[model samples]
Target chain A: MRVVKTGIAGTLESSDVMITVSENTSTGINIELHSIVEKQFGKQIRKVIKEKMEELDISDATVSVNDKGALDCTICARLEAATYRAAGIKHVRWEEK
Target chain B: MEKLRRTMLYVPGNNAGMVKDAHIYRSDSVMFDLEDSVSLSEKDSARLLIFNALKTLDYEGIETVVRINGLDTPFGVDDIKAMVRAQPDIIRIPKADSADDIKAVEVLIEKEEKLAGLKVGTIKLMAAIEGPLGVLNAYSIATASKRMIGLAIGAEDYVTNMKTKRSPGGVEILFARSQIVTAARAAGIYALDTVYSDVNNEEGFLEEVRLIKQLGFDGKSVISPRQIAPVHKIYTPSQKDIDFALRVIEVIKEANEKGSGVISLDGKMVDKPIVDRAERVIAMAKASGIQFDEEDDK
Candidate 1:
């Protein structure tokens, strides 16, 4: 799915990550991540974001995350929320494998 | 099937820090709250957070409960749809006014359980009676469905409905509390008291706990982690009670062996009700981790 508008999800609270997805005219996915635990889990968080974007079938977008030690599941949920908001889709099929 | 619910700690559904570390506090149950604790704009986010937490985190055998939004709200349907898939131990319904309110939610839970390939009654329900109407119909609400295991009082709303606020002496809520406990007892379900709300006032908190216990409440809802220990301590069966129960059990066992229907201890006749109470005492003792020597009398 392609992004229709800017969408944001999550919060800056400890053990949470806020993600903002905006439409990008560029060729590929661009991600900017800011996290306190960047030295340890930065690469892992980036990889998860990229994987989630691919799973949603979005190849081009500007995604940014401000993470505060959130877990992988939390990150995925926020990404899905932001993607849905950006795509302007309601009624998310959450259980679709 | 009756699990210990002495202390249920409420963790805001959107607060990942508290949700992740909730099990460490060792409440008998950790309630992921998606109702009042969450703001309207963040309702969807909080639901997602709790769903993910339930799916990913290991609660270390602590019973997981979720307090969902009321069915009247737009978020309630989706809240139940997401939470049931996560398979919490109990779903607490807020502002439950009658049997219909409970049945409405139960129907949805039944549908979700079937779709998820889970046993139909695996997810239990706990109704929170927070209004005068709910208090009056407490019995029917408690027995509305087979999945309902308990009923809890939410005093904040109840007092508001009563045109008053919560006083330290709890004079305003005595009748409501008594009504709820009686209804729960009549239905053979657990009755849980509301939160004390004053985390700093230890004396007042203890007084409320004592009153609830005296009125025969099974347990209480605790807002902070500091409240868990006191509730558990008060609910634990005393040593004297436990020892008496053990003796009663031993006497009953000997009577059973000899095919004698009549039994007595210290010239006091023991009956089925007495035996049942003794068994419950022993169960409570075991659940509380109190050790006793079985061979002392042997």
Candidate 2:
């Protein structure tokens, strides 16, 4: 799925990550991440974002993540939701994932 | 055994923090709402959030309920499709005025259950009676589908539909409450009372809890974590009552041992109803983590 518009999901809550997916930049996936626990888990968090973006087939988009100690599952959920919203898709094919 | 449902806590579907930590509150059931509590603009976002939460998070065996939007709305069908696949313990139907309204959702749930590789009846149904029409047809709605497990009162809308507001004593919705409770009993399902919106008024909340407990409600829908403890305390059997219940059980067991068809305890006949009540009280006591002697006197 391609990010046609800038879609945002999640909150700045203590255990949540706010995901902002921008329109297709056509230069592969670019990620900018700011996190509370970046020093200890920055690489792990980036790996999650990159893997989730690849899983959703979201190519060539500017992805921004503001993490507040959210878990791996939460980060994946928020990114998938943001990607779908940017793609203007309502129905989620959960079985495929 | 009947499960203790003294408190069913409402957690907003969109709040990731609450969704992750809801089970720690120890409510009998945690209901994630995709309806009125969530704003219109965040409908898609909230649905996706709750779906993932249900699929991944460990609720630690506390019953999970998801209140979906009405089938009339644009988002309602999507809510059902996602929530059915997500597999919460129950899905509450909002504005369920008639059996057809519930059947509409059930049909979709059945189909989704198949596609999701789950048993056809894996997901249960709970109806929210919100208006005078629904109150009148309470029994039908309660028994609408075999998957129906409860009927909950939505007093805010019911009171507004009656052209009034909630009073201090809840006099206006008395008939609705009694009727819903009666309908639920008649249908052999659970009867859940509405939420007390006055979160700060502990006295009033206790009073409402007492009234509903007296009226034979199985539980109350609570909005705050603070409301849960009081409801559990109120639902817990009193020590005096528990003592009497223990005696009743002892006598009944002794009679059965002696091949007696009838039993008497404290000069009154202990019938089936009495035994059932005693068992229920014991169950509640056990649920409250109360322990007493169980050695046989014989």
Give the number of the best model, judged by TM-score: 2
Among residues 3 or more apart in sequence or in different chains, the pairs in candidate 1 whose N, CA or C atoms overlap within 3 Å are none
- TM-score against native, each model: 0.93, 0.95
Residues A1-87 of candidate 1 have per-residue lDDT tens digits of: 889999999988888899999999787889999999999999999999999899999999999999999999899888888888899
**What's candidate 2's DockQ score?**
0.61
Question: In candidate 1, what are the lDDT values of residues B71-99, reduced to their tens digit?
Answer: 99998888888888888889999999999
lDDT tens readout by residue for model 2, B37-142: 9999889888888888888989999999999999999998889889888889999999889999999999999988888788999899999999999999999999
What's model 1's lDDT at B247?
A: 92
Model 1 residue runs over 4 Å out of place are: A95-97, B251-272, B295-298
Each candidate's lDDT (Cα)?
Answer: 0.90, 0.91
